[model samples]
Target: MNEKRRFRQRLKDFDLTLPESKKEYNRMLFTPVAQVYSGITRVLSFGRDAAWKRKLISLLPEIPEPRILDLACGPGDLSFLLALRYPSARIEGIDLNTDMLDRAASNLARMPGNIQERIHFFPGDMNELPFNDGEFDIVSGGYALRNSPDLGRSLAEVHRMLKPGGYAAFLDFSRSSRKHTGRLQLGLLSFWGRLWGRVYHGNPEVYGYIAESLKSFPDQAEFLRLLEGFGFSPVHYLPRMFGMLRITVIRKN
Candidate 1:
């Protein structure tokens, strides 16, 4: 079979509730589209993806030579932004998909020597990061949490990776607790996402995964509770696009 057929078959067979399956599905979904991931994000978000990321970075407090971690750093957009905002900081980006990592690496190569030296990308899972406890001063994840195969485990890992008083910020689609409202949100997201997926990849399921994943993700309030339960204190919450998207900053306590 051809690549598109294989992708559709895998998407149909994979179960999002299973962590390993979700991880593998994500790899299959993104690998073929890594080159256009950023562009698609801009289109999907109505040209606000970059602005949302910039707002996320602005929420972070300045730290001198801080060590930063960008989890699920697809194409290293947030990682590069953090590097530019904090020139002396060392930024490490980790993602499950190697194709995305390759794109990030390619982007890094074109940068000047100083940024190229400070930023590095690697292949890894967020739920089981290969780093020491309290290793990072700041951790940022753009559209990361909602995509995690195991959100609680991933949040626990984020808590474990951060130093005391360190901050972590995440930008992602927000869900509502109310069933009807959530269904409306998911339906709209799925329709728009699948439209783009069909246009770009000739497969609606390619981007429809976003809505499917969000179906299992916690709503805003529950998300905040999860963060607090994982030893993080919510510091800033910025809702954009009528609460459909949010940038949340929390501090490690």
Candidate 2:
């Protein structure tokens, strides 16, 4: 059997599920290749992924001596960006995956002395962050919520960590509320994801996980409600790639 078919068969045989599927695929994405994840992400998003991140960064409200946390910060892409832009900010990046953190540390090693001191990474869970309540001035995560096993619990942790009036922003894959439009966009994304996997990853089924995760994740409006229920006010969002991706900015009130 071809590798793609075999991959599908294995998932079928094991009866793998949504968040589980997401978890497995994410591990695979990071396992075989850690550094290339960002490159492939930018490519698959048609080069607009960085733009979405920039939008999220721009939404960050000015706060005195901001203490920032980048949750599920895969390879510290956004975290690095934060360090570059906010020299005075203390940035802590947390993720469950050690290899990603290792790579993040390596990247941090290359920076000048002050930046290296300001940005750091450690192992932590987003659902139960280790810090005390109201620890951060801003919390930003890229593409983490969609993969979160419990979005409500994760958002709660985010809210708990932020000082009142702190901002939390995230960039992630988003979908249309309309079923047909959602389907079409996901189809195109899945096709591209699989193609990237086949060409660069030698595992076409790996990136197909994107489509599956999107289908299982909350839509734009639903997620906005989730933020509000979590006690995040002044919630706002921006879409890019014609709604293929989004940046949601929320603040604790």
Candidate 3:
């Protein structure tokens, strides 16, 4: 086998590099190569990532005016959009990656006073959110849930942090339940992920964790059950990108 093939084989056997934890995952992708995350999102979402984010933002209750929490708000892509959509709402974000938070702050600082004033970020853990109980009206996570180290507790924290009738809207990958289709999807995504990673970061494995992580992510039905078990009532979700991704909108009981 060629050197590149051998290298990947070795990595497959031992690297096990994945954003699957509180510390290891936090430190894995926030390197310089992570600058391409937004672009990769755009391409993979068919230039509709922004629109999808907007849609996720819309899933929240807007009338009473929300105290918004954007968990794992990397680079503020969705947070910034939330600010534009809810100029007066209080939008706070918490993340573990300082580099991503720096980027998020820089982007937030560029907005007009009306928007910039309402958005902020800090270091936090999903299993133990820094906020008090029932502290928010709407909680939105952009591609954050699946990456969580503890999905149960991460969601439990969401339930704890939101007021009764509060909404939780999130976007993330959805592993197809159909075994054959999932394999095909994973193959295509792996090829595309490696290509994008190599072209943008000079590291073919930069985004390979996406495919690896999806392999273990719960299928949609199971995920919905998990959310329900957490007492998030009236849960609803919509698949995006031909079911490659999904948006869940659930209300705290």
Candidate 4:
């Protein structure tokens, strides 16, 4: 089997089951391979992902300088962007991947000294975030939501972290296989991802994971329902590229 399929089978065989302990889950999913795969893609993807991230970050309110939390901030790109955009905002980059946190710290250290102060990096578990209630004005994640073992539980944690009127903006692939729309888009994404994968790292695992995960994802409507069940209101989703990608924004009451 191809590397991607192998990884999928591994996840499926385990049912993508995370350990009851957050620490163990972190050790498994955030392995060295995952970190390298993510870090390289940040560059190999020609930086288009930043634009998607920017779109998500733009959803926050402007009245007060908001404290932002970036979940699974591999390599710290999103955290850095938030700090750059809202210079006065308090920003934290939290992830299970220590390697990614290390890279993020290196990235931050390399920045001009002034920009480094606005960002904080820490090893964190999304299922059980280590922050107080109603702490963040905005919480965002990129390509990270779908990887959660329990999407609903992850969303619940996000909700618990936000203060009333705070916003949660997230991006992830949605299962689009229902219509010809989803399949065509998935095929194109798979082709490009695999091509890039081979050229950059020759490990098809990354591309294959994208395809398999999207195939296994909940439909957009179901995802919306999940969000609502978490007590988020004003839920809105923008389906990109014929539903292959999605950005969801919801506000906590």
Using lDDT as the measure, the top candidate is 1
Candidate that beats the other on lDDT, 2 or 4, i.e. the better one = 2
Which whole-number lDDT from 0 to 100 does residue 242 have in model 3? Answer: 76
- Steric overlap count per candidate: 0, 0, 0, 0
lDDT for each residue of candidate 3 in 67-136, tens digit (9 for 90 to 100): 9899888888888887777767898898878788888888788888888778889877777787899999
Q: Give the Cα lDDT of each candidate.
A: 0.91, 0.80, 0.77, 0.73
- Candidate 1, residues 9-55, lDDT tens digits: the string is 87899888899988888877789779799899999999999999999
List candidate 4 stretches off by more than 4 Å: 1-14, 17-47
Distance from true location, Cα of 250 in model 2, Å: 0.4
* Most TM-score-accurate candidate: 1
**Residue lDDT tens for model 2, 1-253:** 9965666566444323444554555554555456577788878877877877877887776676789999988788899788766778999998777788888888888878998888889987787788899999999999888767567788999999999988998888889988899999899878988898788767766677677678878887887877888899856788888898888888898
Clashing pairs in 4: none
Candidate 4 residue lDDT tens string, 1-253: 9965565444344443444533344345456345475545555445556677787767755736788999888788788777877878888888887877888888899987667877889988788888899999989888788766567778889989999988888877776636776677667768876676565545554455566556656777777777788899756687765566788888997
TM-score each candidate.
0.97, 0.90, 0.88, 0.82
